[model samples]
Target: MFTRIQAQVLGALGVVVVLGALTLFLVPASEPAPAPVAQPAPEVVDVPEEVPFVTHQVVGTSREGRTIEVYTYGTGTRDILLVGGIHGGYEWNSVLLAYEMMDYFEAHPTAIPADVTVHIVPVLNPDGLAQVVSGEGRFTPDAVRTDVPLGTGRFNAAGVDLNRNFGCKWQPESSWRGTRVSAGTAAFSEPEAAALREYVLAHMPESVVFWHSKAGAVFASECHEGVLPETKTLMQTYADAAGYKPILTFDAYPVTGDAEGWLASIGIPAITVEFHTHESMDWAENLAGVTALLARP
Candidate 1:
């Protein structure tokens, strides 16, 4: 009996009532916003400050193409070149001593005299050092091969005795304890020796010091011509400070193509500060010696 319009309105009202009832309970209310996640505290890392005196550089390459690093201290024009391990791992203690000196200069920048610049080549013969040391970079006393002979680690990969490869009175063969080691085909023939020669020529350092072992004396360098007058002063200076006997000549045997001698040949004062033993660095003595050298005018 109802009209079509009235029937349609009644149907729409019934659908709205059902939908409202479902929405009132079936839809869960939105949950409160997630509690802000606490971000982890940013990691705090401490970096070490660089020392003013420390400046590391690669001066040259070794026979096996290993980098020969130099640690230079100070910016003075009166440069002093200090070399260690020229005989390679056979005299590793010398290299250790050189490293100790570098560390000292870095920590105590004021310890180095204002007018002096110190250049330290800790290991000149890398291939030979590798033969005795197991790992790369810094090494300890235990890293050395104890059973190796005294002369075992003396030569480079090219079988050249670097100490005898300099240009001073050079020969094809040189005697080390009468053993007759190969000096090289010619003066500065080996890459290690050549690199050192080039560096010495370029820098023309005011003085040079080569550290060795088991000699128990400080020695002045002399070419075939004769010893430089300044060589005596350097030898005495180091010796007086370190309490070692200063000897003008290496009377143990005739040494040819010696590094110090080559320095003398070029008119640079050079000294061989040989430690008493192969095992010990003689740190205190050498340190005093170096400190004295740095304080020189």
Candidate 2:
């Protein structure tokens, strides 16, 4: 039924189709698709700083069972220990000053000299810190007592002025508004004082800084024995930075059993940094002083 032209066209189309199918199915497998490239593994991101090597936390449980922690920093051959708020409620600003130092060390890990280790005990009296924080996170030595239903919170839960309670030179229990208060039972009877001693013994730091309030001077680490020659150098370092005159002797009172004196007795160059009437004015100067101390050549 078909003409010669039609038959030839149909035969040619069939051959073309068969050839195309054979070429695709039998193409000798050109190199398999290049193996999918592997992207480099993603890089690790930001990491929080690690807690510095802690010599130890000399633990002193407060009358309220709260922890009074002493953190030892750095491990240089030349070491320094900074203690804050041994006076408890009487000197709340002292504790805050210590905390500021702690924050600085945490944020600026490299601020401390590589050759020296700094020990920071932020709060000497957790009991006092608790009362201070409950009201204002910051406090001062001259903070006037406003009418409060609970009365003055100037002592521990056990009603002992821990500073006065140390046995450096024990005195008869005096009254601060009818609160009998020179000192309690015996030397180092107060847990906070005891904890400080424990830390000082354990670290045996080359120098020490004990923060106090209202005194507004850097007392050379001194005692009945004498002012340390190294303490004179250390005081000058901090005093030069603060721009305030350093009072070498704190002959303000018949003070005894104070932590600084205790430290000095053992020949550790200890300084007590007393702020102006207000605690807030103390920190920036102290920061400058501390940096200068750390940066000393």
Candidate 3:
């Protein structure tokens, strides 16, 4: 019943609708968007455990309030005390040698025997050491002053010869190479000396080795009791191992109130292991000597 134009229009609309359906049928649908991917968590790392056997302590302080530290390695009952820098920067090599020993032990913890405990005091007179060296605790050879006088930085801040402040054959004044030096007001009057004395009394090490310089020898210690028989064995043991000359006494000059002598007076065996020079540590020789001593009966 519709007119020809109206029928044509309807036919065109229907054709347009048919074309749209054919296009939809020909096109394929896209895949759904991929689900979000989760990133892996960061890896966890474990911290290194501390070495329980190696330990350090601040036993006392120097005259200028500098800490006097002791580094202990091993956990045995028989203790061996190694001291250096008692003459401070005047014999700075001793301090260097002590630190070298500490470094060695730290690297080779098992180098210490099962029966022995090693205690090291790298700088007993930090003030005197500071007088010459620029840094605290550990220092290098470059830190030392080349123009330092022979006797510079030899005494503590109190101007007392710490070596002469001990009780054995103590006098108000002591001689060092014919030059008189103060022995402190009395036995262990200086705080540094007193601290060492207290440590010795408290721990009572089986033996002690005090490092010095320019003597090129191992001298045994003595007081009123002369030298302990074990001291002779120790001297020979260290001297033979290190190829250093062993002497029964330091007779070149008179030394009073000496720390080694004080040890002898109290029945402790002690020796002075003097390095060949003030600059070199002689590491191999001393290490062999220490090893031999540790292995001895």
Candidate 4:
């Protein structure tokens, strides 16, 4: 009943709808993304345990607040103290030697006798040591400066000679060779000396050894009370083993308020073991000496 033009329009519309359906059938729909997979938990790791029979402590602090450290090996009551770097950077080799001993003991814990304990003070004058070596607590040879003067870093930050700041025969001015150096305002005036004093009083070790340099000998200590009988025996034992000369006294110069002398005043047997030179540690010789001492009765 419709007109020809109306019928033609309806047929065209129907043809367009059929073409749309054919296109929908030809093109495929996109697949949904795969579901995310869960991950397994990460593995946990255990921290390494601390080394056995080896202990470290901060006995005191330097003038500039640097820690004065002590490393103790073994658990025996007969304590033997080995000190180095009392002169700071001037005797930096001593510090190196002390550290070497620590390394050795750490590696061979059984090397120390069951009845003996060894305490090592690596550097007593940390401020002076820092003036020459860059770092804190521990350092290596390369950390030291070669161009520094011989006596540049020998004194504490307060310009006092720490070796002369002890209590025995203390003077306002002390001599190192022919040159006069300040011994601090009073005995134990410097904090470094005070720290050492406190440590010694608190824990009186059976004997003490202070490593120094350029003398190539081991000298016995005395302050009014004369050298302790045991000190002479210790000097001889170390000297014989290390090939160093055992001297009764240090007369190259008059040293007042020396740490060894102060120790002698208090009846503690102590010796100053001077190395061959300021640069070399002479490890073999020192090791022999230390071994001999440890083996003693």
Candidate 5:
């Protein structure tokens, strides 16, 4: 019986030793070394480099050093100045409208009348435009809207009513029935106004078309002196094509130091086209009006 017990104990010890060896060898010493994965080469994305264009940017830096871009097209003696976005961010439709025109000319390239040069100051107030661009990307004609920043942005970056900052029958103070107005420190005090004035003086464009919104009719500029003869003809020409009646005078309110009036004083014909529709871009209609306006008499 004693011999049998010793023999059983020896057998158990041998089984335990074999099991311990199996566990040590079969189990992972550390984590099983992961199989090396051959990673595919990373894809190289193609990004186009900056390509310069013929369109020159004449910097009209605002008081805040915001750059206002002016683009000129065509190589002609007869120049047509197109000014838009005068109301800044609130009336982004005007800015879009102007940009649309620029796009048109860019695509067509030959749309610009050879004898007539076209100049576009697409965004007159960079600060205002920056506000609009940061919002939704679209501004429709049906939405005769503006994102007024604290209602203080109705004017330029410097709070000068650009239209009211011109030298045309300028006033010390102008009234805006909408509860916001600015006339600047003096006539053309704001850099925006000065830049435009300088460009106008330098270019001496034969006519200027200023775009606005919600009025839906075209108006010719007139001060105390009265409308110029060419102003009436210019308005008629555009209206005849656009199928809208000509509003010889704005008469909505008395405006002083108006840009149109200033242009008129310098013997340049200027017409203000105020779109009637909002929330919808009437660019098609207005383009016709402009095309007709640009058509040779």
Candidate 6:
């Protein structure tokens, strides 16, 4: 009863139904093979390691038995020693300035020259520092007791002017701000002075810089022999860079057994960088001067 085209269509539909039935019976769904058990991807993470800038060594101890830390920056052959707080609490800003310098190097290790090694002794007289500043590392200007006699905080716990206890034209006494100060029994008499002396003798640094305050000038170091020619150049260099006056001699007061003078006596160029005030570290000027010194060929 069907036409030719209709019969062909019906026969195709019948074959498709038979195939669908065979597929359903033969395939056997099998619960989709347990959904193939999805797995988690492996994770990857990256971490950076920390880099150290300087090496610290306990070269000596203070009079109060506190550690006098010497931080060494760079391993270059030519060495320079930068000392701060030799005057202790009287020049506490010097210690802060030295710490600032250390921090700069730690932050920008590349700023240091390849051929130079810089050693910094932040506090040479911890006892004297303790006299003025109560805290260990940092203290504000208000912490200083100006009520005390001017030079009372300048001397160490043993009552000796550390700057005047070095082995150069050393005397039993020295002068500070028109007041007579004890220079210890002899040269290198105090433990602090002895420690610095031993370290200097052992290392024989090419140049030495001592930070001081309230002079507003950069003074070249000299001994009985006279100023080292290199000292004159260095003085000019720092003074020019820092916008400070370059002084050939410190005639403000007669000093004996001075640390800088001792370095000069041993043929090393030495300088004392005096800040304009005691309250501030004068960080910018000193940092400029330090950069200029390091840039020297």
1-297 per-residue lDDT for model 1 (tens digits)? 979999999999999999999977676678654799999999898876654566888877887888888889987778999999998888899989988888888888888787888999999998888888878888889899877776667899888899899988999998898788999999988888888888889889999999999788999989977878899999999999998889998878878898998999989999999999988999999999988898888
Model 5 / residue 269 / CA error / Å = 0.8
* Clash pairs detected, candidate 2: 74-117, 174-182
TM-score, per-candidate, Cα-based:
0.81, 0.70, 0.82, 0.81, 0.74, 0.79
Judge candidate 5 at residue 17 and give its lDDT: 97
lDDT of each: 0.88, 0.71, 0.91, 0.91, 0.76, 0.87
**Sliding window of 10 residues with minimal summed lDDT for model 2:** 143-152
Q: Write the per-residue lDDT of candidate 2 for residues 1-297, one digit (tens) a residue.
A: 999999999999999999999977886787565798999999998886764655556477777787777665665666778877666655666777776777677777777787788888777776765564554434444443434324244567666666666544556464444455656667677777787788678769877887776667888856667888888988999988986569788664556666677777777888877788633637678889888888765
Model 3 superposed RMSD (Cα): 18.2
Cα distance off (Å), candidate 6, residue 18: 92
The stretch of ten residues in a row with the least summed lDDT in candidate 5 is 136-145
**How far does residue 232 in candidate 5 sit from its true spot (Å)?**
0.8
Where does candidate 1 stray beyond 4 Å?
A: 1-52
Model 5 residue 228 CA deviation in Å:
1.1
The residue-by-residue lDDT of candidate 6 on 113-226, one tens digit each, is: 988888999989888888888777656677777766654467888899999999888999889877899999989889999989888898998888999998899999888889
Off by over 4 Å in 5: 1-54, 135-152, 178-180
Q: What lDDT does candidate 4 reach at residue 192?
A: 91
Q: Clash number for every model?
A: 0, 2, 0, 0, 11, 0
TM-score of 1: 0.81
Instruction: Give me the displacement of residue 224 in model 4, in angstroms.
Output: 0.4
lDDT at 113 for candidate 1? 80
* Model 4 per-residue lDDT tens digits across residues 185-290: 9999999999899999988988899999979999999999888999999999999999999999889889999999999999899999999999899899999988
Any runs in candidate 6 off by more than 4 Å, and if so which?
1-53, 138-150
Candidate numbers, best lDDT first, in rank order = 4, 3, 1, 6, 5, 2
Model 1, position 221: C-alpha lDDT score: 85
